[model samples]
Target chain A: MAENQGVLVYLEHREGKLLPIALEGLGAGRRLADTLGQRLSCVAIGSNIAQLASQAIAAGADRVYLMDSPELADYQPDIYLALMGQLVAEARPQVIIMGHTDTGREIAPRLAFRFGTVAVTDCVELNIDNTSGRLLATKPVYGGNALAVFSTDTDPQVVTVRTKAMAPAVPNASRQGEVITPAYKVEPSVVRARIVRRVLAESAGVKLEDAAVVVAGGRGIGGAEGFKQLEDLARLLKGAIGASRPPCDSGWISDTAQVGLTGKIIAPELYIAVAISGSSQHMSGCSGARTIVAINKDREANIFRHARFGVVGDWKKVLPAFTAKVKELLAS
Target chain B: MNIIVCVKQVIDPEAPPSSFRIDPATNRAEMRGANPVIDPYGEYAVEAALRLKDAGGAKVTVISLGSNLLREVVKKPLAMGADELILLEDAAYDGGDSYSTALALAAAIKKIGQYDLILCGREASDTNAGQVGAGVAEILSLPCVTLAKRLEAGAGNLVVERVTSAGYDVVEVGLPAVITISNEIGEPRYPTVKGIMAAKKKEPLVWKPTDLGLDASRLGSAGRKVKLLRLYQPVYEGRCEFVEGQTPEEAGANLAIKLREAKVI
Candidate 1:
């Protein structure tokens, strides 16, 4: 067995490009690796993903491990878990950072269990304890009402970083790195709980997590028709539309657009919350926005607590004027 | 078919944010005046199990582990049509991280010894670790798919519509698998009055660490590999600048003007 050293990032990719969270996690791993005077390495696994190695290298990695196989095209937990287990044994990284994404959520804990350990997940902050030389992960708990700091002594401390919580690694094409193709094999026969089909969500233009501006509604918007009016503002601002849990659960919008603790975590330039009471669960997702504007009839609504600017009125009456004024200001 | 669901009693996450408090001395949260309730996500798990039972003949067994677990809160699942309830109630089970919690739950599950499926919320509202389900699955050496929005039984396997960032994937898994339920499963059906009456008459089976053949080191805080260094509420030090106008419509327009002036667009 090799000595546990260096920081390794588990890179997640869709289609041919890396997810934003992947680069974010890489940037975070880079800080830790540099702080510890260790090399930063990353591994990419999928079909025809040998090309992503260079991308990973550009994103602050000193070395890149590439594993590409047709059977590994779609993320099957078992095959990926087996491969990760083997790689951990070979590289023996001191810390493994993964994005708190769909794949990360599935693989991180299982992999830690294989190592007889536990993973600190959905972390917003990761630090190297100067005294103990251990990884400290701070995460939001109680539906974002409180934050808890945790640390594990086990080797190869595993962490899944929340999306947008860390700065994305700046691509440096001139950065020097090497790509190594690790031993790879896929035995599909050993896999269970396989994905048979996918019903891709119908979202057009900007995504909720990446949008510069987001116009979101809540139960006070009444129903689907009210969301249509919010959509008018979203279009005017060239932003995506989101919702609180009630609107989504009531079928007013896609669950993909729900922004809360259990849904998407977003950090946009501007977030326009219309008639949302701003439950801590909902605010946890968008509190990172640069500016928040709330329009609601109730003056004492929780939404005002988090907003930078507010209009105390029905969204039906307030939104039209807000949209028209924003249109005029942008055009001028 | 037999199904097992794991539920947790948590400080009501719906309580007003002002009521949210933390005891830094003990590194735990104390909801000033709020009562505990069954985790909303766990309620979704119960709903999933109940739906499976509704579709076919199955017995839904509910399990919870904690200290000072309110009977009304833990019995919510039973009122939701579950056939049986098991409680691992003891002080030794408190303060366990996901690792130790999974150990206790898994041990209890092994004692039950008959389960076709295991369901859990994606994460509890209090801790929000989102690891217990997968931890239990790994402990039991079973397959687990997280964040399911829809589920159905087909032949000897299950068809689950697992939620994803981009969309939903149709998954097929054999019997004796674990799945974590998400919010998109839809609001859990309300427990009818008759069901509540029936729940009032039912007494849950309670167990201690000894009953599960486990001891202190593996049961709770002593067994926790991840230590809670500190817990506290994040302060919103900044102030909210309310934009007011003669009329609501003018306020809306002024809000737009303020954004432009701040160059925050």
Candidate 2:
């Protein structure tokens, strides 16, 4: 079978609405496609989501493939894998891109297995090697202690880019593209696991992965009581409260709030580490933070090496003062 | 009823950070010491299955995919009263990621059929992929509940409290389901001395890919869809400014001044 030569970006959507990462993926796919001198294509699979095709074109896709079905409405793995597997088998794009979100995490690995190709996850950056024209993916490894570069000798390089790794494209109202609705068959056996209900996150403002600022606590926070102060500070800063693996392992905090290779990876404008010694596992999740502030009594703490600013003192003294100052500044 | 709990051996969580690394050429994590313990989450799954057996008298089988070193880890679970142990080990399985691992495990599970329930850790401490449980569930055509912090077996269904970012959700699924236990589940029990003594004489059934009817190509790196290219430590370019003053109050003032200067306050 002759394979599709263009770059294909998977457009992720929920409840019939496109996600921000989809646009980012399109922007990235378009750039790679332009470099390869091929057209940019996108695949959108969900029920009654034809309206999303226009958005993909507006972002830079030259062609859009739509796989609409009622079975896809809820992100059942069987239905999604079957539909996406069929699309990839037919389209055979030289490269496939997806967002490193919940959906991408679940589907990409399985799709890669079905296709017999590599799918790099949580890539922070993607570019085509000028010499080989192969996709070069860079991601953090060993909990964020290191950055790894990967490239494949095979065609159809599949990768999932981290959110905000690429900038969203400028909306071009005049841009147009061909929207092909592919016909697919949903195997009765494919719908094995069903999502009975989606539990929405409590905080409506921002998730730790998407937050601009992150304030994290560690064993130095004393105990469960310290999180109350941390929560107040996080709210005042309009940021999210994160924790080292210790607190989460100790059951003081939820695993979702854990900041490490095992937890949520976060890249923010500023990361404030309170009494965190900055283990490599914790560091992997926040290596992308532009500026890091460390407050610890141990002057030899490893976290100081990664911090843009450091305060060698007790957080008990530093946190209250820091919180008050931030409050005062916001008030002014 | 038959049950299989997939367990792995991992470095103790309290181990120092410098102890964890992978040999670049081999692409396998290097274990610094023999202090490896049963992955915390895996222990939870084992305990949950044991509890189920204690209540319903179902047969419990503990299955692990790793080297002979896993025998040490399996001993603890066996002492906890599991009936049988199966270890899937081979050189080809080395450097395999989550998908391939799941594929091999699914093949093993298929060979050992008539299982009423399968339990797995929500995520492994090493790869932290959190995909194998779901992947196995997909391949086996079984319903799965990921990140179940609390679980109970009912008359005809399984009742679970699944943890998510929002909070916990109460869910009910029929039997013959897969449930991945979270750390939020209670701590695993330690093996008793009597149980440990008995585990010493118990031999675990070892199998290779051929034994389980899995294609060799689908059991290792070749079966993996994700590959690690190169890994290097993150570079720290930021310089820290240490605030100094005579007293705590003065140091606080100096810190405030620095924050104001940066406009971060």
Query: lDDT per model, in order?
Result: 0.89, 0.77
Task: Estimate, for each residue in A1-332, the C-alpha lDDT of model 1 and write its tens digit.
Answer: 55699999999888889889889988999999998999999998889987788788889999999888776787777788889988998899999998888888888988888787889888999999999888889999998888889998888799899888988999998888998888766767758889889888989868998899999999999999999998988988889999999998899899999998778989898999998988889998899988888888888777788888878887787788788898999999
Runs in model 1 lying further than 4 Å from the true structure: A1-3
Give TM-scores of chain A for all candidates: 0.94, 0.91
lDDT tens digits by residue: candidate 2, B160-189: 777654565666677798888876676777
Worst lDDT 10-window in candidate 1 chain A: A183-192
Cα lDDT tens digits for candidate 1, B90-153: 9999999999999999999999999999999999999888889999988998988899999999
Q: Which candidate number would show the highest TM-score if scored against the true structure? A: 1
Residue A210 lDDT in candidate 1: 84
Q: Which pairs of residues collide in candidate 2? A: A94-A156, A118-B225, A119-B225, A143-A284, A144-A284, A146-B232
Task: Tell me the lDDT of model 1 at A61.
Answer: 94
